[model samples]
Target chain A: MKRLSEERTKLVFEKLTKYLGDNLKVLIDRPDGTYCFRERKDRVYYVSEKILSLASTVGSDHLVSLGTCFGKFTKSGKFRLHITALNYLAPHAQYKIWVKPSAEQQFLYGHHIAKSGLGRITENTPQYQGIVVFSMNDLPLGFGVTSKSTADCKHADPMSTICFHQADIGEYIRSEDTLL
Target chain B: MDVVNAILEKNVNSNKSISVHKDLELEIDEGTLLASDYNVFDKENLRSSQDTYLKNLTRDNVQVLINKIWMLQTERVDEAIVGILPKPVFVLPRARSVPKPKPLTKWQQFAKEKGITSKKKNKSKVTWDEELEKWIPKYGYKKAKADEQKEWLVEVNDPTKFTNGEDPFTASKTAKREKQAKNELQRLRNLAKAKNVKLPRVGIPSTEHFRDARQLAAATTIARASTASVGKFQSRLPKEKDAKDIASHVPGIKKKRKEAPLSVVQEKQRNKKLAESILRSKSTILHVDAPVPSTKSAKSSNSGGKKKSSKKEGKGAKKPKGGKGKRDLRSKVGGRKRR
Candidate 1:
């Protein structure tokens, strides 16, 4: 495993802050253990020192995976967070949207959330902001970027899309082979 | 009391290395020695009267130790009877690792295999000299020997060999030397055998002969790639048969693609610093690129640097603490007012 370069770290940090915001500090300066971001095979893993040191014993090429794959760098060199990071991101999400029961299935099927399905949205959530989508019962089902701001959602039509679909929990089954 | 009458109190801070102390000071030094007790006391048993309990325990233990020592067989030596101490009672914990068996020298290994026991040196430093008829050192200065002698002149039997008038003393001393050549040869042999550092071969010479295995491999690989046919048709060259060494002076080749270095520490600090700077810029759009922080603009408006710093602190105080806590309270009050 290797550390992210300054330029690469900047890209990863900027994307991470979009979802976690101020809670990003908890990941780096964790009390439970020292954690860091390591890049292996173009994928960044949020690994603790103990796990990383142990994993380092295995040859980089032969080692299949590392501790908690956070995201990967696209072919165009842009950083994208994967669905596997939902467990960590959900707890620290700055802006969140709770989906209605009727639309939870549709969201799981990888469809953009509509205004009618938006059970509740955090106030002042800016447009294009990264947000975690949860069910009305508080189960985090998926996450995506917002299409419209909180203020604009009130005047918009019920059928108009409010949240753009990026990834959902269903990917665990659909893309299980390629997740890591 | 007699020294106190003649003492000068003003000279207390004198810089002399040795100083005389009062009788009371010596007593205090000896009193602190009792703090290092070898016996253990059950703190709970002696909870009320520790000092008296410790005193009794120490006295009884010392008496038992003395009785044990006196029971041992005594020996008279140096005009006194002394008890022969037995093996220690307490086994202290080891403060260091087990001593490793030393690597055997060649002679020791040979002797062990041949079942040749070594003979101890004679304890006497002096040996009887036949020529001098007196005792002389066994090894050092002025040792008695029949062949090696300190004489004024040397008589050479072969006059033809000494026609060039060479120094016969050095020649005779070398001949008299015992195992000098054998010792040097064994030392070099041990050095080469330990790591198999190949000795320079006969017939040809090059600096590449001394290079390590890794460097030699890389150099050979580099040489093969640089040739006309790319070393495909080239026959395997004999190691002993020296060929033209290409890149013999070059140490190593530079890597084309450098991997991202492994320093989790630097990455952690760098990522944190970048994120903090980004977070700060998000709320307050300060001109980071602006030279000297627009205290220049403040300097134009204000007269002194002191006022500028105070004004900057005032600006900081005016900003809300956070986006959620205090801002939510302020927004709630504003919403109520608008209603």
Candidate 2:
């Protein structure tokens, strides 16, 4: 089990701060250099030695194991933000589209929100930009991309579609067997 | 025990004669005492004959039979106890083993050491900023860069704050404007000079040079005079009136002879009769037995027939003459060649 060096953690933290902004803090308490991350052959990030130790101590086996590749680390290596990491980070996301109650089930089922399903979105959010989508109760549903800007939406037809769902917990559950 | 004794005494006193009856009656009457009787009376005899009768039964079989009997007794006791006691509700135990963890690599180990866990918490501890009215991180609230914040702000111009100010580059702008105007004026003057400078005529001389305005006026007068003469000639020539007009004008021409104005019913009847006559004529032509009238006779018959029939013959005659004329010309040319 390898641990990330202080230098590597700083590098990752800096990149995360730039990419995710305030959302980075939700993922890490602080860049204390105690956390360990494994880089897979496909460039995905995963919790390795530290999580294994935690698992042994906690006596629990269920754990999130994969993180998505976020931004370029070097010309060759890339930094990835884990999908599970987004669970903590979603609340801190600056841009968000709050989905309607009627669209909650469809959103969890990994269907993109139709224009009408866009109940409330962060003001001044740009079009084609990545945004977090939440349910009416403010439970983060998943990540999505805005199809139209807030200004475009003001004059847009009510029936026009708006956001595209990227990933969700429901998709993870449905694909758990295949993921393994 | 008392019931068994009473039954035994009754059986013994009632049946004293037959020994078989007495034995059978005793066996039947003493149900509780049967096992004791087997143990006490039949034990020695059964032991002696055990080799012969119990050859098929194993120790296991005997033990199983004893256990089955014991179980039945216990089940009866349990049923009685259950009838008196309250029913117990059973619950399944919680699963002891957790789900299997996904395999990790070296880098993940490093990441995990830095307080990273594989199990990401679904609920975020990030607090909502009341002032900002948005969710914020637990620690180290990162305010967006001023430039980024500016980018996110909707662009709006304050019309009320707009002030009419003096032109900042009045001298340069006015000089440039005057220069552009001078250049435009120069271009216009050059275009006028180019237009005024006459170039020698190229290509063939125009025929229009032959006629001056006076010649044109004379030509117009000649054309007018010719048109007037032509109109006078046209007026002097007799104009052929329509047959309906001729009939109306000439007293001798009967209105009935000229087509009378027919009502819809009359027109339909006339059309039907005309169709019947046409059908009769077509049938006559189609039938081999019906003689085809000679050309002269056909013409005379057409003239004698109704005006409609004469009109139909006239149309038919014109079509054949066109073809016949060419044939006649060919024949005449052939005759001349023969001569």
On TM-score, the leading prediction is 1
The root-mean-square deviation over C-alpha atoms between each candidate and the true structure, in angstroms, is 29.1, 55.1
lDDT of 1 by residue, B1-339 (tens): 757744654356343323232233221112122112344457875998888877766555444445445677799999999877655544457899999876566777889999998586657878786765677777767663523553446776568545346677766666557467877877886777566677656665366574665556655666655666555554556672213343354334323465566466766677778889766654332122113323334323222222221221111112211122223443422111121
Query: DockQ for all models, in order?
Result: 0.08, 0.00
Chain B TM per candidate, please?
A: 0.31, 0.14
**Chain B fold agreement for model 1, TM-score:** 0.31
Candidate 2 C-alpha error for residue B321, in Å: 78
lDDT of 1 by residue, A1-180 (tens): 667877888777777776777788878877887788888878999898899889979986799887888888877787777889998999889889999999999889877788889999997665556789999999998888765667667776787677877778998988798779
TM-score of each: 0.40, 0.27
* Best model per DockQ: 1
Point out where model 2 deviates above 4 Å: A1-19, A25-33, A41-82, A178-180, B1-339
Give candidate 1 misplaced runs (Cα > 4 Å): B1-262, B284-339
CAPRI tier for the interface of model 2: incorrect
